[model samples]
Target chain A: MISPSIFVFAPLASAALFTALMVVRSRNVIHAGYWLLPCLLAVAGLFGSLEAHFFVVVQILIYAGAILILILFALMLTRDVMDPKQRQTTKFAPLAVPLCIFVGLGGALMMARAPWPAIQAAAPGPAEQTKALGLGLIGDYALPFEVASLILLAALIGAICLAKAEKEPAAPEPVIDLRGEIELEESVSAGAADGH
Target chain B: MTANLTHYLALSAALFGIGLYGVLARRNAIAVLMGIELMLNAANINFLAFWRFLAPNSVEPQVYVLVVLTVAAAEAAVGLAVVLNVYRSFGTVNLDEIARLKG
Candidate 1:
């Protein structure tokens, strides 16, 4: 029997793959950045199809919403947004293409050959799943959770420091011709005393 | 066809491949970062698929996914900042142009 989720999953998977291809192939960086939005949304949809309800929300909210925006901001801040004249890929792109294809095919083949011991148990109800997740985070995973927070804080400070405009060193104090000024003043005084 | 673990894994592999190509081939550093984000998403998909299929009752996979997401956010933030800084100093974000360390 075909699962109903296959219908949802198929379209989302296609969208994700297609958009990801567009992301890589687009000459315009901003267009590539925009392509990532749908790719991320499609991944979020894939999360929903997997019944990772909370993750669906998080994926959409964080990956699609926050990270994509950050990327777009970076794109805008950078000068060359649409440089069609410049080659988008490197000289080794031909080699990279074959290597990537080999990697994907090898991974798929390995996964197909592996005999996964998939369990038959169904996921808990959404409410229970969320509660368990919350408990797990605060209970057994407390240390990691705290560590993640610390990492975020550090990243925040680091990003600000890195992106901040470098202050131009104070202009070197103008070299004062103090000797010339002093000589002129002494001559004027000498002339005045001679006149006296 | 039924959507199974293998299917999701295959999709993730394909996505990872595309991301790898992006990272390896793109001349722009931001494009490379986008590729990294794609690869991370592929890993996240793998985590959720495994959680749903191999161990639905356990919260470990989900927790791990959350942690990965947190790290990805941090990475993107720091990475973009680095890219901006690179652009400011070098006046270009082209990976080839910023090859001062190519010794």
Candidate 2:
């Protein structure tokens, strides 16, 4: 039977599914970016259900607010945000059915007996949790954080290099014909040169 | 009236399944990124679910989820930055066509 929580999570789940499909199947990349908003918000609701109030707020702010907007900007930065032409990649038909069955069964059964653990050893309150996180980041996991930053730096440099590399090749933009529809394929990458 | 772990699990499962569909079916790189984000969010829900239903007191998962949040932010920033370059070079966002390094 459905509970009141169903009233909330149900719509959230449906929104997530709808937006996800839109994001995948949408012809326009920029349009897909806009559709991501609802999917991220649904995930935020899931976070709320998990009792991570902080995560819910943060997901909204960072994922839905910042990241989605960034993606939209990136899509817009390219010239072709609204080409109604449908492009073709390999038909994504055969794989969808088996994948759905596998993921559905795997996710459900895998989570069925998932050891939902809660530490009763020490009752760390929310305030203490923040304190612990700060300590862990600075004291123990500082290296990993720094490492991630370095990787990001590398990606930044790589993006820059890629943008600069092919100033010479000078090939016109590659246009893809999906189902006989021409779609312009340009990299929104800021760093196309270095990696190239 | 309170949602339980099963509720979170079902939600997460659905999310995961959707993500799998996206990763498999979508050809655009950015759309694939969206799929990955969905998958991560599903896992995050699982973390918070365990924390709530199983623990209900400690905030370690909460902290960890925040860390994951930061990581996801970093990833999107960097990944999109790279994708921009990928698009510029290849002129196509289809993952299959970007196989220049396939040598």
Q: Best-fitting candidate, measured by lDDT?
A: 1
TM-score of chain A by itself in each prediction: 0.80, 0.63
> What DockQ does each prediction reach against the true complex?
0.65, 0.33
lDDT (0-100) at residue B8 of candidate 1?
A: 89
Model 2 per-residue lDDT tens digits across residues A34-130: 8888878877876664445566778899899988886777666553523547552247646785786578667777777766543333334556655
Question: In candidate 1 chain B, what residue range of length 10 has the lowest lDDT sum?
Answer: B94-103
Q: Model 1, stretches more than 4 Å misplaced?
A: A1-4, A168-196
Q: What TM-score, computed on C-alpha atoms, does each candidate reach?
A: 0.87, 0.72
Candidate 2 global CA lDDT score: 0.68
TM-score of 2: 0.72
lDDT of 1 at A76: 93
Q: What lDDT score goes with residue A99 in model 2?
A: 81
Model 1 Cα shift for residue A171 (angstroms): 9.8
Query: Where does model 2 exceed 4 Å of error?
Result: A1-6, A79-84, A113-132, A139-196
Residue pairs that clash (backbone atoms under 3 angstroms), model 1: none
